[model samples]
Target: MLWGKNIYRLSCISSGMSLFSNLMYISFIYSISAKNSDSDAQGLVHPIRDPRLLSGVRPGITSSQGTSLQGSYYLRNSYLRHNLKENQTGVPLFLTISVTDTNSCSPIENALVELWGANNHGLYSGFSKSGSPSSDCSSWLRGAMETDSEGLAKFETLYPGQEENRSLHLYAIIRTDWYEHSKNQTVDSDSSHNAAAIVQIFFPDSLNHQVLNRTDYKITGRQFVKNKQDFIFSSGQGVLKAKAELPKSSICGGVQAHVQISVDAHASQNITVTESPYQCKTNCKAYQNTTEQTTTISATSKHKPHFIPLAVIFFASTYVFYG
Candidate 1:
């Protein structure tokens, strides 16, 4: 009986040592995973400041410089009157725009927010310019909405793909007093009443990389410009950049981007609108004419399993049994 008890004690000691070793290994893995998660969160929250700005490089585009010719194509007829979220391809982007008064720092209600961007293939909906190669007048990733009493406007669109000499961006024209305009009305310098700030909203480079690497955007090739290398992005001074985050409970596995645009409601910036020579006029058609539908995608939760505590409890119970 004494010999049998000695062998049992030895076996329990050996088992406890093995359990302790596994606990240490698990702890090390959890620590490393936590560190990596923290690093990723930091990157999402705080993007790197443009290096060109630090070098005293003047921006090619200034706030007072107004809108670019490329942005001028956002006319009343360019987009459909239906929901922009309908029949869209690529990863979904839940974009929210908050319009505020620069002078009062208060929300600007009833403001018209028009948003336009390229599709997954880096093609604009209505234009046939060098970079935007659509001739069918198909309106895919473009729409307009009015701000609510809280000065918020939301749109569901696809993540824009890259174009030549430009980083991924969304063109917006916010107007304080929007009136019934002709179908030929284009956002221009003379249309000051309908144009408050014609700004381009940008995304973080890290976020851009993750989205663009997906299957839908990957076929566009790798010959696109980075935010730092792009002249317009360098000149914008990061004020127009959007804050991107993962949705807390998104049925769609895409990103949520938000940007608060502060504009002088009373003042009108002179935005030049030049006609594109390559503009497509014939065979113009809307992408989808069916009834609007909202599609939701389920995302897998990233929460880690609570196994450590259970492991500790089991180890304690084992030790007590042996004691």
Candidate 2:
């Protein structure tokens, strides 16, 4: 149902909470130094200023058929344990979301905070198929939960991997009481509810360095990319730095980091806009699924590819139903 300026086409595009005993969670990251390669950190992150500059991305790698940025398909607890074997390879990443009213600094209690990100190997769950209209959308890395009374929502998941030339990051949607439902909700021109905010939480390049090169992360023999090269940042404003704790095991130590997000408590409905990263170079490869054949697509080169600027797609389409 795409009716462009002169042509036509079609396209399309999570939550919960719990109260806290003031609970403190853990992110069991290993502090191993990465060996493959290096780059200077950008350390640049910006708030979503224009809502129509829409880009909902899952790397668009296997999705030449396109994907809905509004991936509210699964809303599980903080522990996103859908695939047991893949979950085992992941580290314990404790994600804490602290929600507050920007002007008041008061905690926004019971806010719905939904989060999703790529796994340690750079593939998202449920939608990794490379064929047209990808089926088998079961996954482990995407989930949603309600914030506790303290305005915090915590998740236990794996560290995300890198793709393209960008640094690793997580995507989230924060909603006030009226904006909680991502799948069926909409914001009006004269909004009566608070607008939703789509955000990306970037991990520090230093920590990303250590994590990406881990034996579990898979990609080897080459250098890892840093913040300086990520497409989302004009610089490195969104990189979250990591803090190390005492070692819990022989392989790695316990590490943690926390981030605070401000959601507008008032209204001005916003469509999640996106800024698609410049397309990457193509390299062909083949693989097999347990019961069938499948293809994995990538825009990467032998060496890490650099990002270029593309005219941002500022359209406002959630998702059109197929049937």
Best model per lDDT: 1
In order of appearance, the predictions have TM-scores of 0.58, 0.51
Whole-structure CA lDDT of model 2: 0.43
lDDT tens readout by residue for model 2, 143-168: 65556667787776666776545577
lDDT of 1 by residue, 1-323 (tens): 99999899888887777776677777777767665654322212111122211111111224445545245456443342325655658778889999987888888776767788888777776664443433546566777776777789988888888776678898887766432222222221222223556778899888777777767786544665678887878876423889999767642487888999987755543333334444454554332111111011111123222335556746675774565
Q: How big is the positional error of residue 20 in model 2, measured in Å on the Cα after superposition?
A: 51
Off by over 4 Å in 2: 1-88, 178-195, 220-223, 235-254, 273-323
Worst 10 residues of 1 by lDDT: 290-299
After best superposition, candidate 2 residue 297: deviation in angstroms? 39
Question: Which portions of model 1 show Cα errors greater than 4 Å?
Answer: 1-64, 67-73, 78-82, 128-134, 181-194, 237-239, 248-252, 272-275, 282-323
lDDT of each: 0.60, 0.43
Name the top TM-score candidate: 1
